[model samples]
Target: MMQHLIRFRVFLFAALMLVLTAPAAQSLAQIASPYDVRLAYVWQNTVTLADGDGVPLEQTGPSFAFGQGARLVWTADGSRLYIALDNGLYETGGQGGPAVQVPGIFGRTLTFTHDTGVLYYLETTAPQDEEPGIVSFPLREANTALMSGGTGKLAGYFGRFASGTTRANLTFAAALYARDGGLLGPGRPTLWPSYGSNLFGTCCFPDPGLGIFTLGTESYSVWDATFMPGAAATNTTQTYLAGPTTNGVIRIIDLITGGTRDYAIQIAGGLGTIERVAWSPDDTMLYFISRYNPTTPLMLNVETRFPVDTSSADVTLYRLNLVTSTIEQLAWRADVYGISSLAATNEYVFATVVDSNAALINAFNTQQVAASLPSSDALLAPYMPQTHLWRVAVDGSSVADVRDDVWGLAARPIR
Candidate 1:
């Protein structure tokens, strides 16, 4: 009886998504591209990058209240910047103008396929315990709604994926969808058939050319679904797992051939757990941070594979070789305070350091692969306070190449 009820609810959710999406899909065809980066952070605002100078080309904001998380992607041409905020989806011109908001969602988590501009996100209606599912918002419908605030619904039904249970399991599941859209259409959620444990920390590379790849607590998995612009669905699946129960092994999966790769870093001592994983824009390397010993009040540790360990007596930055899967110690500072956040691009790596009362942005050049740290004054600058977003040049030209009030910034070539 329980199983039957669950299936019934899943079917209902699927129906809702289909009804909402069909019209939007039919009305819209192609999306323009060459988009700048879209940023959403804790303060519930959005911003866009204008040029390569690392400045806020244009700014838009206070769009929604509960924007817990967001992912920004440009269309293939870079003309439109799409932002998926918690419960709300929006897009704006590359130069930053009034953002168009897409309605009809009640949850967080957003992702987009750059090729087709087929927007994909997760949607959940009331009943906190019920599993949330994947939904599609056609670019045409979304743009129309954004421009005119038309009566048309912004979301279309895609399908439902599985979610995690406890906080740990929840982390894995959240990680899976962190970057990549959550698993669409379902059998048991990924990582469920085996461990019966909830998958946490989900992230994906949802390119049609690559299919979809996800990372979970025990391992990383890939699906066979090809997310072509206007095609019918194909078989969805979890292809592989980076096994043998270990903690803090941040794995990056390739969506094209279902390849599973692991980065074996002792991220967080055996304490709290690794929380964030970010991929470099070029998609060759990954950067992750782990908060360790959270149970102990005095000794809280924040560890990063980017070659720094904030929890130790000395703060150090490390260089990681993606092709070789190696780590080399680069720089060390005795008076380092705490790492607030980390961001990287193909050209440079930016680390936000928070000390006594001042916060700073540290920049590193990826071109210089050797493990020698740049001078502190040369690589970092005092970040203006109350600003969550900062932009830096990928070419290592000047730290002030561009400046904007963004909650988050990605220093990479936007496609």
Candidate 2:
């Protein structure tokens, strides 16, 4: 039952890895961007590079067969991209280059540090009695693995911070760790699964000249706990970290001073829970996805408390202005599951929305047809929903379907 629940949550976020006919490739000149922005995404089981407009610039040869836990990350300079697939991990040069498989390395949940050029990830294969540990590999020197000393199901690197202040630690699960695997301090225990990890570094960082590294994790008490990295045990303190609670409110901790700021989400009737959040590059605005209300009675261990599960049609995307504390709807699509993936830039916000209506129909048909077969005849696989990747203008002026059947997406750092 535990395995099934874990797999089900993953299936809800990842769409099927289908082989679809690719549209004719277009020249890079077809897109518009000031920094010549590029995006790395998993499209129809293949690793593809696209321009800012979501037009395919190049389709790397390597593809993910299962597309489960498939993730993509770009180097700070946008010269190289690291891709994690079901079979193994692969790397590709910026454009028009064949993806070379990174031998002896296959894992899930990836995070990259710009300062050290090291990629930290959780090992997929751990001893049965032992928990999976976080591992790191220097990008400049590949195939060499170093023990990061801590065990976590998810790992994240907070690379963006104000000048004169730095985040030298990697957030693994609900704790902070130095690059060498030393335990810095502990965060909230509820920071697992999706919403917690999604908002790791979305907002809240040490102010310039604070000379401190900050970390935060979601909690059930309506407010998330913030921590200042310390030797051995973390010293608890409030700092910049913000997200929605189950109570239809979003709260943030000040980065410089220790205080809390609460912004109530304007909703009509039922409670609103913001699931995922992304901060614009300028730090002036925030983009988030929300659900109307979650009334499903799920088991404690299997359900995420922060953003309760709701119907696909009840989800809406919103943006908030930090200066005026105002909220506005950015986009919303009916008959689709909540936005599973989100990333932002100065010009546009990218989101992955799964077609829930189609997924439900597929699930029903598969279950009904398989009911007649013996349990040993075949394993029942969860049907995944169709996924669409959209690039919406930062100002809410326009939205475009950059690609269909995209499971995971990562926008290259343009700064």
Could you say which candidate leads in TM-score? 2
* lDDT of residue 12 for candidate 2: 16
lDDT of 2 by residue, 1-415 (tens): 0010011112111222223334434343423443554676766656777766666667775754342445565665666777755356678876547788776454433445443244444342331111133121111122225533234323223222223222121111101011111111111111111212222221122210111112234111212333221101100111244555434566564544446577776656643545556666556677876655323312222221122122344566788897898878877655544455566766788877654433323433445433343211222233333567878888778988777767456666554
What 10-residue stretch in candidate 1 is worst by lDDT?
Answer: 1-10
lDDT of 1 by residue, 216-263 (tens): 222333333322211111111221222111233444443344455656
- Each model's lDDT comes to 0.32, 0.44
Question: In model 2, what lDDT does residue 298 have?
Answer: 20
TM-score for each model: 0.45, 0.58
Candidate 2 achieves a global lDDT of 0.44
